[model samples]
Target: MYDDRERDTGTGRLITGLTWTLLLFALWLWGRGLTGVPHGTDGPATGDLFALTPAQAARLPRPAEPLGSALPQRVDIPQLGVQAPVVSRGLDARGAVDPPPFDQPGVVGWYGAGTAPGAKGAALLVGHVDTVTRPAVFYKLSTLKPGNTVRVVRSDGRVAQFTIDDVSVLPRAGFDARQAYGPRRAGRAELRLITCGGTFDRASSSYTANVVVSAYLTGTTR
Candidate 1:
């Protein structure tokens, strides 16, 4: 997160309580500058980052039904070689999505107030791209391409599998609440893996954009 006030601090900053709806989390972008995006203020030019053309939308698969009541315990992205524990988290006092502490950047945090991973709604899982010293769990999340698979091990001993539809790198200034956090289609189970991305500004200690990877339920294993 970029903050002119925290420009001197090497650690990234986080947006406090935002008035946005269920589509809640937004991490500060990274870059090598000292610009700051004030909390709740209108963002700079987003350059249509969230727009999906006909070609991009056509690549997404629409599932007929959702999964069962099992809770996700872990998320595995074989292509990225990412396997990490899932912890339920809520909003901070400021109403912003409360991410896991900086010391545990490898852990993924699920917005427990929303739909579960295998359920018939959009499930949101978020993590840090890096910490003060090194890269974090989702450092390579933006590298995932379409048709790649993500498996979520559930409490009921089932694995909920999702196929990648698309990935977007949205600038923090013009972040779209619906595109960033909404379900892809009605009555389908989807997942959005979010993290900070873009140019890292060593001067401000923030990134320039957020990487949102969109996926939908395709299969499950018992």
Candidate 2:
């Protein structure tokens, strides 16, 4: 992992990470899937898929219980040379994972109320692919390949290292929420990085598809 965890953590303010006291409300929203980041890119057809290396199917032991809400301070994708501050995000009034303000498009927002990084379940990290002016934090997220490492430094002092397992681009109109957002397997620490990809329909001012990168925890450090 990069050696700029603490340094970068201090550089940006996090989007407020809040707990889901309204579990019922949050669950209803989760069913809607976490969709918020928008990028301005004129990609291929909606159903057109980008080829990715097959993921090495494997598994790992997970903690018997959830880690004590270890809030992520920063996320680093070594292969992509990315280091961005992470903030916690809760559901919007519409029950979707709200994106960080466009002005701070470089910042990433973790679903604070969901599975914390390193915990058993899917932890979400979302960032914009592009902003009103230029490319954003996860602009090149689709280029990430299997085995590429994503290191997330949490507030609890442990660094969770996740290995890319799969990448998918699906049409937003017929997206399978449970299939896309569901955990790859039970009882494992996993991470999902999401951003807008595919064609940017100027007619609607939104992308026609989404890029989802899935990863699983392989190791950690203090």
Candidate 3:
């Protein structure tokens, strides 16, 4: 006697398991690549590494005369119902954004070396979907769509709102280093939200692609 229902359930479970295994594998690969540790590393090089067009550079935030001491401390997306605190830090030697506290699953991380949110240029914020054990802050970031709103709370008590323009997924190796980190339209502020995605590679322990969400300033609150 062939049991169709039993067979279908078994097949479904197999597919789900397979998907998880593949995701783990992709993540492994991504982690391995980031750990190569560049030799003769210069501590945080300045200037435009992307050779941005003059027009693009004009849109980005201008460098502060003394560089502001305060940075963003929180992020809120009313549409997604996400309101996570943000931690400020520089990149690690491995060229990967550092992970935040595992317990704080909804926190956003700001790249302190680059433009601050609300500044003329683009600001970068990164979060992890998972940290080996559990899902982290940005697990739902992929759900954001165009026209969604994201708000940033800076340490100085200023709030900035950005409207989502686009979301994209790029292979880890194919990520646009310039566009992702470069300046934005003249006099307009921009933000980038990044996280791991695509299939996970267990052998490498990292995601195959990075999910990026780009947004532009739409409003501000004093």
Candidate 4:
């Protein structure tokens, strides 16, 4: 018999072990599906897709110039009422970018080896959607829409403000890491907030898809 507990554990592990090497490889094979990441047993089903509608795209603020490199201290998403401390994390032996510990569900993990938030390249931030018994830091990530704001407080005492421009619930079958993680424009300071999305499959014990929220630096303040 399939147990819900197993499903929860599987989802947690699959997301925690998201590989960075394989994901970055998608940059060259932009049109090809991603590999190495675990997939659910269910058929192809992309979860709720939140993108920039024509009107929203027309209203998005201009991208701000990339800031000098600085460590991130916290991330704030006012729309979702999320204000969480950010911690630096590195890849594990298997090349997977380690996420925050399951016990630290309120914390966010930044890929330390990648571009810092507000820098020229796309910065990656990952968090758990939910722990076994409760919601996690990025639980409401998919609910964010284009034009919403994301504020990242940095060690340099500047608040880097980003504007959400795209949100996608990419299914596992053809997961495209390039689209999910790469910067949308050259030289732009970008950010990606990732979490598990879609239904959890008992057979595979993992969520069928991932929710990736794309945002870019648009403003800043102290």
Candidate 5:
């Protein structure tokens, strides 16, 4: 007779592990898809979808506003060897930032629903560390340290440089989203680099925590 109890237990474990592996793999593939997009791009392409929740869709910043003019065009961090194009898109229902094209994976964009770049507030730039297939831009972002520099190239050809003053990892659950994306004091411009880090959980399809790099503007072409 077959030992049904033992057989079921083994099958359950296998299914659990396979589920996590597949979840992790799917996340990786999504990251790689961004790299497949063509480089030196200037506008949205066909099949390039940008979907947002009703709230996000309604909250899109108006270009006519002064704060809207502060939106960034590109982000460059020589210290970390990063120079990615910037985009502007609203957030999803989950509050997570939208993903970029796979071919133009060098792109990073402003979380439109959050703070605007170059504003007297926390400017957030989110990127993928690695898809299931390969590492993505900002993959080495955690390597940045205090005093390192991050530059932002504006649409008007001006450039703003920021100095890294701190880097910290916050638990996924403990992430203070509002504070991280809130307004800043006068004369202060902050930047935050976000990515997944810590332990990886296949079942949950996420990392244990997020790696965040905080910086402040020091110089600019203004």
Candidate 6:
């Protein structure tokens, strides 16, 4: 989520395109930095970090095999009570993934040039944490814990079921695009739901940190 003076705080600074071979090098050289969200309002002031205990991790379901490429239609996070439409998004002139339009705060933007949801790679999804006047689709994203489920309905008549494995609030100062957007395990289908977190800096019109929720494919349904 880039700055929208009249709408959302600075958010959505995800990597653009699937040219990981070269983008990885570029990000390593100069990590991407994102702006912060607002503070003390109806939105989250900072992201909540949740780590899984060894036993809890062991209790999670095993990873499911990856599916063929298909466009994501909607994303549902049961724990957050979120059911949002997914829209295709491309990179801006600055080479960063553009977020959903400010007017469509409830919509989630998917990186069209990258891996599709349910595919064998990390599919990037971003949303606004809050608008100037109220909380948006991802306002409660940080509250999600490991093992929560995320379901993505794809255009190919399949629903990809993912189990949350990691939730972290990464600082913009040294944002690691590869680590954040890359698949946790090779050949696994991964998903990242991202939004703004941390204190918003009025001067910079951005949030100090980004909330990144990582999940891996665990099941599938029609």
RMSD of each: 11.3, 9.4, 19.9, 11.8, 18.6, 9.0
lDDT of 4 by residue, 89-195 (tens): 87554546677887898999998867789988788898887777677888778878888999999999999999998888886566667667877998799999987
User: Cα deviation of 45 in candidate 5 (Å)?
Assistant: 37
- The numbered model that scores best in lDDT is 6
**Per-residue CA lDDT of candidate 2, range 1-222, in tens?**
211211235342132112323433443344234334344444444442344533434332332333444889999998888989999887787766776877897799887766788787788887778777778898888877666789999998988888877777766775665566667787777888888777766666666667888888888889
Note the residue pairs that clash in candidate 4.
Answer: none
lDDT of 2 at 126: 77
Better of 4 and 5 by TM-score: 4
Candidate 5 per-residue C-alpha lDDT over 198-218 given as tens digits, one digit per residue, 9 for 90 to 100: 555566665555556776666
Question: Which residue window of length 10 is worst by lDDT in model 6?
Answer: 1-10
Q: Which candidate is the best by TM-score?
A: 6
Instruction: Point out the higher-scoring one by TM-score: 2 or 3.
Output: 2
Task: Count clashing residue pairs per candidate.
Answer: 14, 2, 27, 0, 13, 8
Per-residue CA lDDT of model 3 for 60-118, tens digit only, reads: 44322221234788899887777888887554555445556556657777766556786
The lowest-lDDT stretch of 10 consecutive residues in candidate 4 is: 27-36
Pitting candidate 5 against candidate 6, the one with the higher TM-score is 6
- How much does candidate 5 score in TM-score? 0.63
Model 1 C-alpha lDDT per residue in residues 117-216, reported as the tens digit of each score: 9887678888887776667788777777777899999998989999887777777665666766787677788998987766655566667677788889
Candidate 3 residue 217 C-alpha distance from true site, Å: 0.8
lDDT of 6 by residue, 1-222 (tens): 211211223332222333664444432222233433454533344444777789998999999999988989999999989999999987665666677877788999987767789988788888888777678899888888898999999999999999999988876676666787688898798999988777777877777777889999999999
